[model samples]
Target: NKQIIDATIDYTVAYKPNIAFYETQGSKGWDSLQKTIEYIPKECFTIADAKRGDIGNTSAMYARAFFENMSFDSITVAPYMGRDSVKPFLQFEGKWVILLAYTSNSGSNDFQKLKIDNTPLYEQVIATSSQWAGDDKLMYVVGATHPEEMANIRSLVPNNFLLVPGVGAQGGSLKEVSAAALTKDVGLLVNSSRGIIYASNDIDFAKEASQKAKEIQQEMMGYLDLLC
Candidate 1:
């Protein structure tokens, strides 16, 4: 995060801390995350990739922790728990609820691709979710692996930004995703977590990481040009 903050002059936008990466280390991990986030520039987006999906009031408090307390700009939410469980997060303005639509993980097919009421589960997720919130407040997690589906999802809700992951190490094609997902405002945020951040184990790791970021940014620049 400090590297991205200090190292790059580009409009890098956001930094996400996947909670599992921190939680696996216990309390110290959580503390480190807090410290890391604190150092992030106010201009850059900060996201808690907690993927928190709980029920009732329990869901509300989790929303407060990330949105109210941590002051994160956006959060990833799982809709399987139902819209009620996810709606509490939508109450914040200028904050985004990145609802999981179709993910890149190999096991996602077990449920996401399954048919329900004659519609694919992911399509149903997009259809049902489009009703709960407008595009400005709600974004969807459409994995880069399913770039072809992005256009279909957009046809459902054209104005929303799609927080796309799996572009780098996961072999998701950025070119294809951008082709299907780009909005007039350059809507897709193609995340390259492990591929960029963990690029090297050598002492000058941050420099190597920046190189990876530069590569992605150039590709994004091309997409931005497409918007123009």
Candidate 2:
């Protein structure tokens, strides 16, 4: 894990640790996660993929745990409970709230695509939650699996950042997503989990991971230049 962090310093812009994986190991896992966050380069953003949401008071404690205790730069949030569930995370200055809009999971179609007032719920989530904070403090989770919908999402919230997953092992095309979603801010944080970190299980794992991350970073550069 340390090797991967060291290897990715130059090739990636952020590191996200899915909290469930850590919580399973109890205190050891929590310790490892904290150390990992510390090891990450200051220039790169750190995200806690906790997907937490609840009533106002409970949500406030979660905000404190992640934003104040662990000190993550941003966190992934489930916006099902409306403004109260999400507002606590947005209260922290310089920290960000990445609301789940359209997830990449197979079951996402269950409700995220349901139409409300003639618009998809995911679209409404983006449109409404974006009003909570400016682009700097709020982002949306738009999975790469929905490349077809990328353009429309961009149209809805053009200025906000997007924490996109489903690339690499998930069969999401970075090239296609970039074409549909790239904004003036280059507003996409494309994530490749198993595809990069597990590129090889051998002793050369870190080397292979670095190579995979560099490949993605280099590809993103061309698209970024297009905006210039």
Candidate 3:
């Protein structure tokens, strides 16, 4: 874990620690996560990828736990409970709430793509949740695996950033996602957690990870030009 952090901190613009991974290990995992967050450079944005959403009051505490106590710049939220479940997170100034809209996993199709009033459930989630916060404070999770729908997703929330996973290890094409989703703000945060961090297992793991990050950064530069 330390090797992964040391290898990619320089090139990574942000780091997301999915809380479940730590929860499984009990106190030791929590300790490691705290150290990992501390070890990360202050300049990079941090996200607690805890897909949390509950009743209004409960949601508020979850927001505080990550944004205030843990000091994550943003967090991923499940919008299953509607506006109240998400509103508490928006209450914090300068912190972002990345709502899960369309995920990369296969099971995402089971619900997200279902149509309600002739529109996909995920579309409804995006359209409705966007009303709670502006682009600066709200973003959506759209998997890179669904690149074909990116243009449609972008059209719905033209100004908000999209936190895209599934790149690299998940076989998502950065080019396809960028071509379909880039906005004037270059509004996308494509993540490649396992792919880059676990690039190798030998003594050269860090070296390999660094090279992988460099490769992604170089690829990103080309797409970033679209923003110019």
Ordered by TM-score, highest first, the candidates read 2, 3, 1
Cα RMSD to the true fold for all candidates: 1.5, 1.0, 1.2
Ten contiguous residues minimizing lDDT sum, candidate 1: 2-11
lDDT for each of the candidates?
A: 0.84, 0.92, 0.91
Tens digit of per-residue lDDT, candidate 3, span 1-228: 677778787778888898999999999988888888887878989999999999999999999888888788999999999899999999999999999999999899999999988999999999988888888899899999999999999999999999999999999999999999986665688899888878897889899999999899889878888678
How would you encode candidate 2's per-residue C-alpha lDDT over 1-228 as one tens digit per residue? 789988877888899999999999999999999998888878889999999999999999999999999889999999999999999998999999999999988898999999988999999999889888899899899999999999999999878889999999988999999999997664799999989999999999999999999999999998988898
Clashing pairs in 1: none
Every model's TM-score: 0.94, 0.97, 0.96
Top lDDT hit: 2
In model 3, the clashing pairs are none
Question: Model 1 Cα displacement at 202 (Å)?
Answer: 0.8
Ranking the candidates on lDDT from highest down gives 2, 3, 1
Off by over 4 Å in 2: none
Q: Highest TM-score, which number?
A: 2
